[model samples]
Target: MQALTDLPSLQQVAASLTEYWSPRVVAEFDDSYVKVAKVHGSLAWHSHEHEDEVFFVLKGHLRIELAQGAVELPEGALYVVPKGVEHNPVAEQECHIMLIDKKSTLHTGNVTTEKTRSLNEQLRPL
Candidate 1:
């Protein structure tokens, strides 16, 4: 696992993806879990009431849509969505991103949908 491994390559982990929207845990540091996901299309609008989510674009482009506005993130860009803010992520094309969030964070806040994934699913080996 990542705890015993040395500096993992995000690219390699991202390249191992076989589907969209599914995130794989890569490491854990303190209260946060580092993950990577290949995304396309849009994720349901949701919010984490008690945790902020950190998103870093690794490739392609991503857009974080909030109730009042939206931010477009290109490769090498990063953004942090504060807790309790309703937002959705959309990628017009396949995009790879790294997410840093608490271990207790849910897949999609209070709303469960077809895209929602359990923590066990996220922790699967890449």
Candidate 2:
């Protein structure tokens, strides 16, 4: 069995993230992948074409803006953006967040702008 102590602390994971709009992979299990990110200001508008993504606020507040509406997620709160839905995430201050999604999921689906990134490119320190 795995022990919780064996897992890295969120603080340690947060330290490894170096850029905005980029998420670093921390762990994976079955069909889901876990990522950590440090965010500030606004992120590019994008969407996942084939997978839903969960955003969990670990430190500060996170705002998710969609075509229908926008939601504010404070620390300890979580929000799930369904597949094929266009959404943009924003942070007023430096915020730490965790994301859960399928292994094949892309951070920004089909939209290959400067903001699009790969999970491998955003690996966090373990």
Candidate 3:
């Protein structure tokens, strides 16, 4: 079994991330997955068909745009986007965020925006 001390710091892990719109898996469990992503500008407008996605702001603010209205999630705030709800995520500047979702969930649901990315991909330090 691995020890907690063997794990890398979030800052250390964040430093190795080079690409935008791609998330690096940090941890996983039977029911959920955790990923760290660096986001800038805007993301695709999409919704999960079967599961809700939780976004936790780790470094900067994030704007979640919904059909009804938009909500700003500042650092340390957690927002959950319910399933089947259309929404978009936008970041004015570079921001680090942690996402929690179900094991079978996709990064983007039915929407085929430019930011759509594959799921469960491992991101190693370069």
Give all TM-scores, in the order shown. Answer: 0.93, 0.87, 0.88
Cα lDDT over the full model 3: 0.83
The top-ranked prediction according to lDDT is: 1
Q: Candidate 1's residue-wise lDDT over 1-126, tens digit each?
A: 557467658977887799888899999999889999999999999999999999999999999999999999999999999999999999999999999999989988879999998999999977
Please report, as a residue range, the 10-residue window in candidate 1 with the lowest summed lDDT. 1-10
Model 2 root-mean-square deviation = 2.3
- Evaluate all candidate structures by whole-model CA lDDT and list the values in order: 0.93, 0.85, 0.83
Once fitted onto the true fold, the runs of candidate 3 whose alpha carbons sit more than 4 angstroms away are 1-3, 120-126
lDDT tens string, model 2, 37-124?
A: 8889887788888899999999899999999999999999999999999998999999999999899898777577787777768664
Candidate 1 is scored at a TM of 0.93
Model 1 misplaced stretches (Cα beyond 4 Å): 1-8
Ranking by TM-score: 1, 3, 2
RMSD (Cα, Å) for all candidates, in order, is 2.4, 2.3, 2.1
lDDT of 3 by residue, 1-126 (tens): 889899877656655688777887788888888888888988888889999999998888899999999989998999999999999999999888888888778877777766777763533433
For model 2, the stretches where C-alpha displacement exceeds 4 angstroms are 1-6, 124-126
Candidate 3 TM-score, C-alpha based: 0.88
